[model samples]
Structures are given as structure tokens and as C-alpha cells.
Target: MVQFLNENGEFAVASKEHEIYAQFIRDLRESDFLKFYRDMARIRRFDNEATALQRQGQMGLWVPAVGQEGAQIGSGHAVGPNDNIFPSYREHGVAITHGVDLMSIIKMFRGVNHGGWNPYEKKFHLYAIVLGAQTLHAAGYAMGVNFEGKVATGNPEIDEAVITYFGDGATAEGDISEALLMAATTNAPLVFFCQNNQWAISSAVETQTKVPLYRRGEGFGVPGIRVDGNDVLACYAVTKKHMDDARNGLGPYLIEALTYRIGAHTTSDDPSKYRDAEQVAYWQARDPIIRFEKFLRSQGIGQDFFDEVQAAGDQLAAEIRETTFALPEPELELIFDHVYSEPHPLIEEQRAWLRGFEESLGGHTPTDDGENKVDYGGSR
Candidate 1:
């Protein structure tokens, strides 16, 4: 794996030896570094809270991106405003980086909304629950951008790129392969970012592929590289380079981020059932947040700074919890609202039948205020 920072939280190279990757790091101000840390810390806090909410039955399901924060944050920060991002279900960090409202994400898991936020407004698509589905969407969008003569425009500001994120397990899906073929053949300005977090649910990476995931991209004629997904600096540098190349009309690229899935695949999963304790311990020792904190300390960042960030993360978690609880229960009629842009006769008829049935029930009816009223043999 390409690693700029080792597990010991020390740089593998001196400052002067940054070489080609220098452009990505050199221009970064202190605020940028702190922002990366803040983003990761805040998302992890939110992830923990969301998991708790799932256990308490607030959400139907929750996917935790616990250990892979570095990969998501670094790559997310690398993208420009002109770029679009298509994310799989677990990309909370990326969504947050792209200015997505955290409550909207929570609303999605709570089953109260179908992706509550508008994708166009943030240039970030709704999370795709189906494995590898968003890859196809991203490729199609990139192809459309090319068709519009947006590629090779010389002006970096005008040329756009597309980035789609998926996990290692998604690579086994036929949709991913087809997306790769489309991107390569069409030379679409796309970057396929695969966060190879070692495990696909309970299946290990060894079971999923005979060789490294990055190598698969090469067979499809797309240039691919592996990066230490736990090293934010490396992830940022590598993704920035490829994104820049893609925008310049050099075609698509693939990045296999070698990280670990520190938590259960979802709230319903039990990682302890399939994985050994030693493996978990090994990854826990290489925790991205811990390593990054060490680097910050080495750079003379004080304990006071870390404390302030902790407080901020705590505040964010509290606010998210409040907002999540405050979200109004989705009305039963909402399911019919977005089924079709233009109303269909069959749908309207079914909706009317349902409304009448509810009204027929003595204790159930629509109130004058337009809210549903339900009483179980009790006075209203």
C-alpha cells in the first residue's frame, strides 16, 4: 500500500522529500489540516450516535463507516465544487464534507424519508443501498458531461469530473464491471474510488478476489493505484492527482483504498461471529484518528486544540440527536407523493380508497389540520 505516514504516526519521508505529491500537501494551510481532523472526529461521533439510535429502534438500519474515516475525508476534501459525488450507503463522512445536512441522512435511515435532501443542490447524490448501483449512475453522468463538450476544456474551472465511492465488496457486482467498461471505453471523466476495507460484510477480501482489487481496474484499461486508506495525506494526494488528470481529459482512474472496517457492516450484523479478536485488535491499533492526532501533536498542536475539537464534536452530536428526535413522523400519504412526477389514475384511485377506508374506521380520520388522527377505542 502507498503510505506517507506509518502506523507509528511518523512521516515515512522528510518534508523536502514530498516530491510530486508536494502540490497537494504544500498548499494546504493549517486550517485545512484542522478541518480534516474536525471532519473525521465529527463524523465518527455522529456514527456512534446513529448506531446507538438504531439499537434504541430510532432507525430501521445503520451502516457504520468507523475505521474508514481517513479514506472518505481525504478523498472528499480533494474534490472540487465542480465535481459530483455518488456515494454508497456508508459514506457519511463524504456527505458531510460535501455540505450535506446530517439530519437528512438520519431521516433516511429512520425510514421517514427517501433521501431527504436534494442531490442537485449539493452536487452529492443520495446514498445507494444496492451494491455498485451508483457506479453505473456516476459513469452515465460523466459520459453526459463528455457529450456536452465539458472535457479537455483547458480551463480547470470549467472542466468537471465525477467520483463514485463503493466498498471492496461492491467490486464483485456486475454493475461495477459494466461501469468500468463504460468509463474506459468512453473516456469519461470519472474516478472509481473503492474503499477496500478488508471485509465485505462477513466475507474477507481473500474470499472476494484472487488478486488485489486495484489490479482488476488495469484489466479493464483504467489506470489504478492502491493507497493506504488509513493515511489521510496519501489518500488526499493520490485522489487529487487522479481527479486533476481526469478533469484534464486523461480518462478515468481507479483507487483502491486499503483500510479496515472497524465495526459491524450494519446494525444488524455481528462481526464477532465471523472475525477473530486478533484481527480486530490489529486494526484498532492502526486507528486513523489516533494516528492523525499523533501527527498533529508532533507539529506542536497543543492539547487545548484537541480539547476544543472534542467539545465541538460533542456539540455536533447533541445537535444531531435533538434534530433527529424532532423530525416529524412521516405521514402515511407521503409514500404516494413521489411515486410518479405526473399523477396516474390507478395510483390516485388507490390513494382515495385508502383514505376512505381510514375514515370509515370510527377512530381514524384526517383532521381539519390535515394530520392523521388515530384513536384506539378512546375519545379524541
Candidate 2:
């Protein structure tokens, strides 16, 4: 029982968790402890409120990050500004930590666009809905690093690494396997993170594999380690070490975070249909947000601080509400923009035809269901 951070905000890993790690935490400074607590609280607030917006119909659909805030926020803070991040769809916390606009995430859930921010701008890629696709992208990017001669240059400040996050279900995908193989062979500067939220759709972990998912990386010649995902300190410490290792040309590492989803898989999926009520109840007691808050209070933080944190959380929720309602619908012409750098003749021709049809109807095509259908004649 290595108690990394005690109930009171002090830094010390409990001896029960790991003998060596206890000493490691005793060496950690107070500033890092406070940062972990702050990041966890904010990420939790963002997800909790985002879910409410979904139910209120303020957004089309939302994937609640519910229980994994510790895992996300912890690892999110371990990177240098120069490092890159690749995330699967439920990584709103990482986006927030990276300074992505919360309102842009709202617009995505509202079905207004794919993503609101540019990957190049933040060095954080867009969320990949296709399971395990970003892992390959991460591996390829690492390969590019090798080509650029970034590996093992021995300058911790100058060299960089990559991190890709996927779920337990994705560990079973061919893309994940291929990515691991590529990274292992090339010794690419990458980190593979599997959140292991357990259930993949209606199927449970028993249905996926008997042994742990992190072990999958070991067979591929990449070292794998497990962390208590709900423990923000554990997540941060492990990821930070691995990231630093990668920066030092240690190649790749895989981390499997042991945690529960604590909510439905997404807005559209109903966990109640497949999971037992008692199981959900058991995990809810171990909620990451609540657990971390308790840890904070135990560290001598008073109700006043707690009250202030809650107030900040409330303000964040209200601000998102105001922002969501204020977003204007984008023009239809935006669909034709950004497809290509150079205009294609076919695209131009289609745009002209649509413009002519709209002008024929006096610049605005009526979408009234009751009106007779308008058939703009084309070439015979």
C-alpha cells in the first residue's frame, strides 16, 4: 500500500502500495501536489456539467468523462509544452488542460463541427472516433521523430515524445496491434495509454481477454506498467517518468490504468441494460472526483477553500451554458471550404450549380415541407 498522497495534502506514498514508491513520494514537493488537486477538480467539474447540458438538449450528444478525470488530468500535466498528444474521443480533460476552448467542445457535441481547434495549434490532435486509429498516427509520428533524429539525443530539454490514449476495447483492435509492432521494431519515441474503463459496449472485460491489457505491450518488446488510474498522483508520477524516459531516447512504453467508467459508455449507450445495479453502486463509492476531494480536505484544506472551489465549478457550468446558447449556426457555404488547399474543378462546378439553383429561387431556397417540390432542371 504505497500511499502516494495522504488524505491531508501531504506527499507520501503509503508503504502498503509499494516500498520503493513510498520513498519516492516523500521526495515530492508541495507545489506538484497542489497542481494535481486543482487539475482534477476542474476536469471533474467540466464533465459533470457537460453531461447536464446533454440531458437538457443544449448539445446533440455528450460522452461523459465521469470517472477517468484523475487518469486524464494526471497524465495531461506530465508533458512539456513541446510534446504531442493523441487522444481518442473521451479526452475532454486533456483538451482543457492544453488550453482548448471549452465552448469549441460544446460546438462539437452540438453537431456543429468535427472539432473546434486545430491540432497544429495545440500540438494535440483531434479526437478520433474510429477506435484505435490515433494509436497508429502516434506510432507514425514517432517514426517521423526517428527520421528527424530526435531519439536518444541525450538532451532532455530539446528532445520530445508522443502519447496516445485509447480504451480497453481498442486494445483488441488490429490497428492497436499493428501500431505496437511498428513502434517496437522501430524503437519509436511513443507512449501507449489504455484507460481500461472495462466494458466495451455491452461486453465486459471477461469477454475481451483474461490477462491484463498492459501485458499486451510486453510481448511486442515495449515495456508496460500499470497504475491506479483513479489515483491522480500515481497516474502523474508514472506517466511523467515514462515521458522523461522517452525524451531520453528510451523508445516506447505502455501504461494500463486500472479504473472504472462509473457511467454509461456514452450518451447514446445505456449501461443499465447490461450492467448490474449493484456493480455500478460499488464503483460509484470510489468515484475519482470524490476520492480526490477527500484527499485534498485531509491535507488541511478548510471548508472555505472547498466552498471557493465549488463556486468556481458552478461558475464554469454557467459560463458553458451561456456560451452554448450563443453559438451561431455556421453558414452552409462553410461546407465547401477547407476540403482542399487548391480548388478542384469538380468542386467549383458543384458550387456554381448550387448557387445558380439558389439564385433561381431568389437567393433563398425554401425548406418548407408543405410547399411543392422545386426541381431545378439539369443538363438533358
Candidate 3:
């Protein structure tokens, strides 16, 4: 695996093969390090707040990205302004890095909206709930970019690329396989980023695949690389290089980030039932945030900076909690909206049918008493 910072937060070349990736981080300034640390801390705070909101019944569900911050934030920053990002549901850190409002993600889980941000404006697509489906979408988009004569045009500013993020479990999806084939055949300017967080819900990644995920694309003619997902600098370097290569008209590349999921797969899962304490404790010791902090301290960053980040995180938590509580409940008809870009006759017919059904029910809303209320012809 490509790693610049080890578990001890010491920076050294992992191997000669990874030295190329290490070279990319040579020009990074202290300011960049600080920014990375700040974003990672803030996103963890956001993740914690969202989990709490779910527990309090404020959100319908929550997907925590606690341990994968380095992978998300580092690779998120590596994406150029013109590049498009198609994220799986757990990429809250990536969304924030692209300037997506945290409340938009909150509203999604609050059952208020279908990802409130505009993808065209931010170049960050809507979160994909269907596993690995976005890979095909990203492949198509990159192929479109290729056909438009945008790649390898000798103008970096005009070239465009596409990236899709998914998990280890998603690698088993046929959509990902088809996407790889299409990208390779068309030489699409795309990069496949996989955060192998070790568990597919309760299924271990080891049992899910026969080979390392990075090699999964090789048979399709798309080369792959493995990176230390917890090493923020390594992720940034490797992703920046691959993405830049993709934008420069190199065909699709795959990056498998080896990381761990520190929390349950979702708010509804009980990880303790499937995983042991020792495994969790082992990963906890290599916590990305704590490791990065150690690296920063070595560079003369003191307690004051750490304290400031903590204060900022606390303030962020408070602000998002307030925002989530203040969110307005979505109308019952919202499901009918955004089914299509423009109004369609079928949608209108279905919507009208729903409205008629609601009217026939006498506008009676469901109660929270946990009892099934059946409205008979003339009685309850």
C-alpha cells in the first residue's frame, strides 16, 4: 500500500513503488496541512451530530463517515474544479469539501428533500443510494466528455474528468463491472475511487472478494493502485496524480483505499453483534485524526491550535443541531415533485391519483400511536 504517514504519524516512503506518489506531496505547505486537519475534525463533528440526531428521532437514518475522513477529504481536494464527483451516500466529507451545505445532507436524512444541492452548480452529483449504480452514470458522463473532444486537448483548463466513489461491497455489483468495461473501451476520462472500509454492512470485505480490490479492474484493462486510506497525504498525492492523468486523457484508473469503518454501517446496525471489540480497538488505535494530530505536533503545532479546532468543531455541532431542528417538514406531495426534469403526463396522472386518494381519505393523517387504524365504510 502507498503510505506516507504510518500509524505512528511518522512520514517516510513506504516503498520504492510508492515513491512517485510521495513526490506529489513535496510542495504542500504547512497551511495545507492545517486545512486538511481542520476539515477532518469538522467533518467528524458533523458525523457525530448526525448520529445523535438519528438517535433523537430527528433524522430517518444516518450514515457515519467517521474513520474514512482522510480518504474523503484528501481525494475530495484532489478533484479539480471542472471534474465531477459522484459520491455514494457516506461521502459527507467529500460533499463538504466541495462546498455543499451540511444542512442539505441533513435534510436528506430528515425526509425533507432528495439532496437539496444543485449538482450542476457544484459539480458534485447527488448521493447514490443504489449501490454502485453511480459508476455507470460516471462512465457515461466521462464518455460524453471524451466524445466532446475535451480530454487531452493540451489545455488543462478546458479538460474535464469524472470520478465515482463507492465501497468494497459495491465492487461485487455488476454495474461496477460494466462501468469498467465501458470506460476501458471508450478510454473515458474517469477514475474509480473505492474506500474499502472492510465491512459490507456485516459481511467482511475479505469474504466478498477473491483478490485485493485494486486489482479488480486490471482484467478490464484499467490499471489500479492501492493507497493507505488513513494516510491523508498519501491519498491526496495518489488521487491528485490519477485524476490529473485522467483529465489528461489517460483511460480510467482505479484506486482502492484500504481503511476501516469505526462505527456501525448505519445508525440502524449493531456492529457489536458482527464484529469483535479487539478488531475495533485495533483500528481505533490508528485513528486518522489522532495520527494526523501527532504528525502536526511534530511540526511544531501546539496545543492552542488543537484547542481552537476543538472549539470550532463544538460550534459547528451546535450550529448544525440548530439548523436540523429548524428544518421544515416536507409536504406529502414532495415525492411527486422532481420525478422528472419537466412535467410528464404519466407523472401528472399518478400525482392526481395520489391527490384523489388523499381526498377520499378525508385528509386524515397517520397517527403516532403505533396502532393500525382502518377506516371502514361507516366506522373506524
**Count of backbone clashes for each model?**
0, 13, 0
Off by more than 4 A, model 2: 1-28, 362-380
Q: Of 2 and 3, which scores higher on lDDT?
A: 3
TM-score of each: 0.93, 0.89, 0.92
Instruction: Provide the lowest-lDDT 10-residue window in model 2.
Output: 366-375
Question: Which one is best on lDDT?
Answer: 3
lDDT of 2 by residue, 1-380 (tens): 21354333345544454643344345557666666666667777888788888998888888888888878887888766768999999988777778877777788888888885788888889889999999999999989988898767877666889999999988888999899999999988899988988888788987877778878887789888788787777777777777877777888999988778887787888998999989888777766667777776776667886777778888888888888888888665555667767756555555556655775778744233333333344523
Q: Would you list the C-alpha lDDT of every candidate in the order shown?
A: 0.88, 0.78, 0.90
Worst 10 residues of 3 by lDDT: 371-380
Q: Relative to the unseen true structure, what is the C-alpha lDDT of residue 127 in candidate 3, on a scale of 0 to 100?
A: 94
Output the lDDT of residue 221, model 1: 88
Across residues 211-328, which tens digit of lDDT does each residue of candidate 1 receive? Answer: 7898878878898888889988888888898899999999999999999999999999999999999999999999888888898889888999999999998898789888888888
Model 2 residue 212 lDDT score: 81
State, as a TM-score between 0 and 1, how close model 3 is to the true structure: 0.92
Top of the candidates by TM-score? 1
